[model samples]
Target: MWVNCRRYAVQAHNIGCYKTQQRPWVRQLEATYDVIVKECGLFVDQKRPFLGATPDGLVGDDTLVEMKCPYAARDLTPLEGVRKKKKIL
Candidate 1:
């Protein structure tokens, strides 16, 4: 048995794609909710110390924002991509 231990880097173009969409996504959500979205840092799970995540934005006290702006799904809305069976997740 062989395991591939290759490491891959995110391309600059891909990062640009996500950055391009992030602001609009955040703005729309903010306007809809009528609340300010704040930047956050790493949050570790209390039950599992090994588990942690850096969410894209935070809303209020309980809502954690997680944005997925896949470059391939750039043209389609998230719901439309889901309906079309695009691997946006």
Candidate 2:
């Protein structure tokens, strides 16, 4: 796989956007659902030390929140975006 500056820049921008939008979105979810979203750090598997996953939020004891803030579908609701662009993000 080839790494390009444009790709890196795009990824960085997307990450920045997501970070900027994340808190407000999480707050809305908490207010709407009355559930606390616990922030998480990188979680490593004990048995497989090399493998890990960092979830966006942890809801309750068992549910993990994985957020997708797609740059291409920023102006559309999730359902509409998914319907219109099935492969975006």
Candidate 3:
């Protein structure tokens, strides 16, 4: 199970077309961004929250770097999915 999960994580990094996965490159990007921050004098918000809008990493106060990965070619967004659910009601 562990091996399978790891493979899936790796695969998530490489989106074929519609699938967008950001976990794989998250660390790399974070590190790069961190170094860029360190050059100045800032840190990331580790304890904030994981709301969809929370940036993957932020620089200072003006920059927000949110990552994304699409699930499929036609998969609706969170809002769209919610709208569809409402229609069912």
Candidate 4:
């Protein structure tokens, strides 16, 4: 369990760092969605400090966005495979 948790933490950190590099794309999303994306802070439950969330971006009043910037080759490979299968079918 500890090992899994550590692995998840590292994965989350890597993805978070990658997302920071994709701010332009995120800004485009905000423009397309017509929502002002606000910076998010660590939100902790008063009753349970350990239970907290640091969302990527907050939209307007109630929406939260978690952005993923996947590697282009990895992201396109599955879509290409699906397209090929669709052509066969």
Q: List candidate 1 stretches off by more than 4 Å.
A: 1-14, 77-89
Q: How many residue pairs of model 4 clash at the backbone?
A: 0
Model 2 per-residue lDDT at 19: 61
Residue-level lDDT of model 1, residues 1-89, one tens digit each, is 00121124243425666667677878877886797889876677799966766677898899888877666787887578879898443
Question: In model 3, which runs have C-alpha deviations exceeding 4 angstroms?
Answer: 1-23, 31-52, 71-89
- TM-score of each model, in listed order: 0.60, 0.65, 0.27, 0.58
Which portions of model 2 show Cα errors greater than 4 Å?
1-14, 78-89
- After TM-score superposition, the amount by which residue 26's alpha carbon in candidate 2 deviates from its true location, in angstroms, is 0.4
lDDT score at residue 37, model 3, on the 0-100 scale = 28
- List, residue by residue over 1-89, the lDDT tens digit for candidate 3: 33433454444225563134444445555565453321222233468633223234555667755455544424775457457662210
Worst 10 residues of 4 by lDDT: 80-89
The clash number for model 2 is 0
Candidate 4 overall lDDT versus native: 0.60
- Top-TM-score candidate index: 2
Tens-digit per-residue lDDT, 34-62, candidate 2:
99999976677899976766677899999
Listed per candidate, the RMSD to the true structure in angstroms reads 7.7, 6.9, 11.7, 7.7
lDDT of 4 at 58: 88
Candidate lDDT scores, in order, read 0.69, 0.68, 0.43, 0.60
